[model samples]
Target chain A: MLPAHLRMLARLGNGEVTMQVDGPVTQRSILDALEAQYPMLRGTIRDHVTKQRRPFVRFFACEEDLSHEPPDAPLPEAVLSGTEPFMIVGAMAGG
Target chain B: MPGVRVLVGTRKGAFVLTSDSGRKQWEVSGPHFAGWEIYHMKGSPVAPNRLYVSQSSGWFGQLIQRSDDGGATWEPVGNAFVYDGVPGTHQWYDGTQHPWEFKRVWHIEPSLTDPDVVYAGAEDAALFRSDDGGLTWQELSGLRRHTTGPSWQPGAGGMCLHTIKLDASDPNRIFVAISAAGAFRTEDGGETWRPINRGLRSQGIPDEDAEVGHCVHSIAMHPARPDVLFMQKHWDVMRSDNAGELWHEVSGNLPSDFGFPIAVHAHEPNTVYVVPIKSDSEHFPPEGKLRVYRSRTGGDEWEALTTGLPQQDCYVNVLRDAMAVDSLDSCGIYFVTTGGQVYASPDGGDTWSAIVRDLPAVLSVEVQTLP
Candidate 1:
């Protein structure tokens, strides 16, 4: 299952988990595909102009926090092979 | 007219409160686009069903919501607001140069006769026009490119184009006011502009009657008399009879002239409305009494209308865009306060009732008198 931040796309998508990897399967490609389909989530995950990950949003997969990793970098074999779903998380702070 | 629909924009979301011609029994349907800052929502004067809503968030930026069938259902429109050409800088809070940024829309003025043509006023103080409905927008940069753009600064609120007044008689004439930057008029459509603040005296600025640095809170132009404009400045209510060419202070009998939101009656050209807050520092009704002052002969004489409002222990501030007037036969008045209250007066301003209570802080209120 994905984290709570990526789950907001379920309200607009066709109810599928969108686990299919078409080409290269990079983090940027997946988010671009998701934001391409659901325009409402455009700026929530990343800066609309800077294209940087939002300060509060993070990327996680295969028991590793990939938030600071490069967007075009490849993922672990578990995530690449669909054994684990890419997770978009809202980081906790200030509490 | 069949009924009235109040398109209310709040800090969280948008709301639609409808009532029959009586303006008594209302059915509230909202918070549409929940968990977003709805700065403004308005219906087209030509097509009442064509509604436009401005929704934004710090995370998601700005989005325009349009509903062809009134406020029943909505679809998201374009959110991108790109400044035209060289996108220069304005005076920042520290008296430094700050690049213009696209922020939430402050006002939406749809065309008088076209549902597809609408205008949006945005923060960073610029005007935008959408010709193909709201699906796309282009900046009318002449106003921002006026010679005095460098001297313009933001009010306590960001530098925002908060008011847009289009002349019904002359389609070419357009008037827009920005906080801390005074008022401007465009005679040849949107191609050229000039400051029309000749007699405004803002003590906060170095030159009290400077040409371009007055914080105009709100400006209202009666539809019948488009040339006559009424303004609620940072401290006083002013009037300009010759289409903003020259101005005079008409705040003779107001309790306190420091407040936001100035509205005009639907039928009475000489009748106007303003809620008198205590002072600039204290942004609430005087003596804890929420009174709406009405001037029958424009601005000198004032009478407080306080039959159905809170008398004491109430402190709700009214924002500049939170008041509106309907054009029914008897005329209807509506306003929402920062304390989460929406007050309505069906008989003009005689009596008031809280049609809505305990919502998020209201940002703007606009009414559509339907046939």
Candidate 2:
């Protein structure tokens, strides 16, 4: 049987985009894949050494707020099952 | 049809002006919220009766006032609206545990779709959100958690939430620009946020760390094309066709590249407006020229529109929220200056005329047309 694909929803300032990934993904793996695919997005999603989510960027999986969650934490089971979606949101405002 | 009403927020207070049919005669109102330094005043899009003003008093601290009777009477959102310092956290610059205690509210923007949802930016580099109509607010942890180290310093005025742009199509989608922290966006309300500062530039930073948290003063987005956006940085006017994924300099033709405000036409996505000021040294209109420039093709080309503006020495700096474009099909472009003058261009900035002058130092400007 083919592994489930997680639907990842990413929202930037101007618009929103969605992508799909096969397998139960951790935050680190997902970010790695994203950085590998879009080199311009490498330093954007997470910090280089700490691998922590950037200040203006937040992560959400299965409706749970994962902004402060550790990067290595396993995503929710619903996301693993491909029934739930993971979301990455951008911070709004300049102060 | 009733002409557009322009709300001018000034250092002393707030004022209102209504234009005549010919877009000539001006009826000006009081210095409402007088004696208080008005940082920003926004006329609610959902309810015309609601006008929100953010004020800062040196001895009293930051306050958000609401005027239901159209700037006639005002009341604070309650004592809960006050901005006290965070518990035990000290700011790096001044080493003050709570710099917000002495700070001012720079901008107050209420969500157009949800009038009850409001956001305020302060001088201490903090962003606060209120769901219950400004009665209370919670600090967005996402910004507080951002660690830029000691070198990620704020600009002259300090890190602040100067502007907040909500996706008209999706209320949950919001964009915010910070002075030294750069720009950020959130699509799922405030639960999570991402830095959309790609293609943006910092003064002397290398290519690697340039996009993360560069200073951004103002941002303008096309109503129809969410993917297209424009921003006024410290040194350049930039546009991103891919929603800030990458940005390119669009102020090539402008007289000056340094500016605080940028506005887009209500109906035309390709048409935009910005008031250019000289760079850090001069920080005034280019060669003392009081004119507003229009970009008809997304900043590809710009044309100076100065029909009635002063041709002589006119040193003025338009604040980030001082310039506005009306929602009418044949939009009316308006802007106020720090020199206490308001200029209006009825035919989409093709020509210009001064509506009011010598009132007070204008801080922010908002325009609304009553039915």
Candidate 3:
């Protein structure tokens, strides 16, 4: 889903593409970096005016849900180590 | 070589169909912003290559797109449409007060003289204008803040301001139409407004002919004769000769006037067009026929133009913004369906041909005649 959104930002379709976002890289910093690089994705994850996280979009890191957590909260070490992509997943509803 | 480019906005994406001056063969490109809803796309009348498209989606909200090289490439512009001051409230579906909300851009009309100046009509019924292309938009709040604002109610389509007509004869005069709220006109650009639904009759409403709430589907005025106007109301085809101060039923002999997208002939001020659906309950053509009725004498008499169009077993609905006219040596009429077929009539509305089929259920259609 992150790749799909990155593609929406016109940043994909290149071979061995690797995007680097510098510094502390908390959940909030990482998202801010991503949105900074892909301005079109600004409102796709949050709102344009309100900056509120869309109800259907969720965030996760270190095998834990961090969607409702504060923006400045630190992520688990595995995410920052590049072992897993701090996941941005679409929340599922209605079985 | 002179040619025509047909810009189509649909539920799933945007498309550009091109043809030479002959209006015969066609080359189609796109599904740009694929999987997104392209409510409307129109090219600058003066700078024909400059184009503006309203791209939106439920997952991503709204995004305005601009293209400088025709439709070859596009870049995202500003999508922020903040209403001026306290947005206030309108009549809700359950007859309660509901705050005005921004849904999406329904129509984009570029200025006739400038490429960067454009107007956008939005849902929850508001008008916005952008001078620096579509990067940033500011609401022309005088229309929304009018004294009658509270009483305005949403039609089945959620109270969208879908039509914006700038008076070519008078720069300060602008007209806009909102569903379930009738039509409004402003003489001082967009600072002040007045409702222009004097003679419309909607049998479904409580008072039938209230000052507002008429559900005006679309309105059209030939630039040569701006005083004389044509409208496709929710239930009747109407015409007014005195700048919308009053209107009279011109449904005349139309099989059914419960249709959208009324247009005027490019060359003939008195000639008009309307696609008559069966009724409010049945949006498709009458007796399953896809015929565009042309009224050469303005409004009264009508004749069905079906050449090359599906005559039977056809049931596609044309939206208010899905029809347009291209100014060429011979006027051309184009209209698309909810079923994804774009039909063209090079000789006005006498005959029709499907330029492209199985598109993404077109939401709007606009044409630019390239010189």
Candidate whose DockQ is highest: 3
Q: What pairs collide in candidate 3?
A: none
Better of 1 and 3 by DockQ: 3
lDDT of 1 at A94: 28
Model 3 CA lDDT for position B320: 95
Q: Give the proportion of true interface contacts each model preserves, from 0 to 1.
A: 0.14, 0.00, 0.28
DockQ of the candidate models in sequence: 0.32, 0.01, 0.40
lDDT of 2: 0.72
Candidate 3, residues B141-249, lDDT tens digits: the string is 9999999899999998889999999999898899999988999999998999999999998887878568888899999999989898899998999999999999998
Interface RMSD of each: 3.2, 18.0, 2.5
Residue pairs with clashing backbones, model 1: none
Residues B1-66 of candidate 2 have per-residue lDDT tens digits of: 756778888877788888754677888997775665788888778876678888654423355778
The CAPRI category of model 1 is acceptable
Query: Model 3 off-target regions past 4 Å?
Result: A1-6, A14-28, A63-65, A70-74, A80-82, A90-95
lDDT of 1 by residue, B84-150 (tens): 8888999999999999877679999999978899999999999999998898889999999999999
Where does model 1 exceed 4 Å of error?
A1-10, A13-23, A43-70, A75-78, A89-95
Top model by TM-score, which number?
3
